[model samples]
Target: MDSVSPWLVILGMAVVTVSTRLIGYWVLGRYQLSSRTQSILEAVPASVLTAIIAPMVLATGLAETLAAIATLLIAWRLPTVVAIVCGVVVVVLMRNVF
Candidate 1:
């Protein structure tokens, strides 16, 4: 069997993502969402981010776990980009020291 190209895979993924977003917007436009539902939808991004990162933090080594803790603390009070940069720095430093 011929192998699929990486560019093709990326293009397919992009198309799917855009199509899903557009379709969702179109569908949601037809409905009147309740305030509770709208609030829940607004929280989706943070929930998705936590779902993605929680497992990595819990399952990884001491360095990653420690870095995650530091990142969370920073994230509570700082801007997201700063927290991310600080997380990277902490992880790199922890990896070297531990």
Candidate 2:
């Protein structure tokens, strides 16, 4: 296999990503999904987050994990900007102290 240029790889990835999104949006626009499908779509963020965070928490242990969990909870309950700031602050503080 031939090695490719890093810039070419990045540009190809960007093009593929944009093309996929455009295709998805175009297709979804033409079809009306059922309520079940809509509900699943709504839950996608939470499901994805859980999938990502669960393993990280398990690998890292309680303190860091709890901080992340707390951050996520606070972020969900508070304003978007505040939530982001809080999560970042909590993670940074935990990393520095622990």
Candidate 3:
């Protein structure tokens, strides 16, 4: 079998990642996007966030459920850092005190 260094494999993967992204941007830039397409693109980030969080929220216990809800509400109304800190505080207090 042929041998290759781990660093070389990492470098190759990074090159592939950058190349695919450049190709995708090159292709996408050629199009005149419709209003509907723009709207869909704007919603993609929120949809992806929900997809990632929904499963964790659903599988959590009471403290986690409350923490997640508090995080979401805080994040919606306040800064992301505040929301994250609040969530962590809630979880730590709940786990340690009760």
Candidate 4:
């Protein structure tokens, strides 16, 4: 078998991601979703976030766990973007310190 180039893999992934997004948008636009379904869909971002963060919190070292806690606290009152930025900052600082 031929070895795949890294650029080819990256481009393939980007193409697939964009295609799926466009297809999802088109499919969803054609339907009138009920309020309950809409509410469920609105929660997808949080669900995705939990899936991404739960592992780091559970399996990673002290810095990541501490950062997750700090992010959670910041998220409770501040905007999500701010919380995310602060989380990144906290993790970097904690890693450097410890």
Per-residue lDDT of candidate 2, residues 5-54 (tens digit): 89999999999999987996798778889999889888988998889878
* Clashing pairs counted in every model: 0, 0, 0, 0
As for candidate 3, its clashing pairs are none
Model 4 worst lDDT run, 10 consecutive residues: 52-61
Residue pairs with colliding backbones in model 4 are none
Question: Which candidate do you rate higher for lDDT, 1 or 2?
Answer: 1
In model 4, which runs have C-alpha deviations exceeding 4 angstroms? 1-14, 77-89, 96-98
| Model 4 C-alpha lDDT per residue in residues 1-98, reported as the tens digit of each score | 38999999999999999998899789888899999989999999999998987889978889999998999999999999999999999999999998
The most accurate candidate by lDDT is 4
Relative to the true structure, candidate 3 reaches a TM of: 0.72
Per-residue lDDT of model 3, residues 1-98, tens digit only: 26998889999999999998799679867899999988988898899898998866767667777888888899999999999999999977776765
lDDT per residue for candidate 1 within 48-87, as digits (tens), equals 8989988779887889998998988999999999999999
Which candidate would rank higher by TM-score, 2 or 3? 3
- Sorting all predicted structures by lDDT, with the top scorer first, yields 4, 1, 3, 2
Q: Largest TM-score belongs to which candidate?
A: 3
Query: How do all models score by TM-score?
Result: 0.69, 0.60, 0.72, 0.65
Give the distance in Å from residue 92's predicted Cα in candidate 1 to where it truly belongs.
0.4
Supply candidate 4's per-residue lDDT for 51: 95
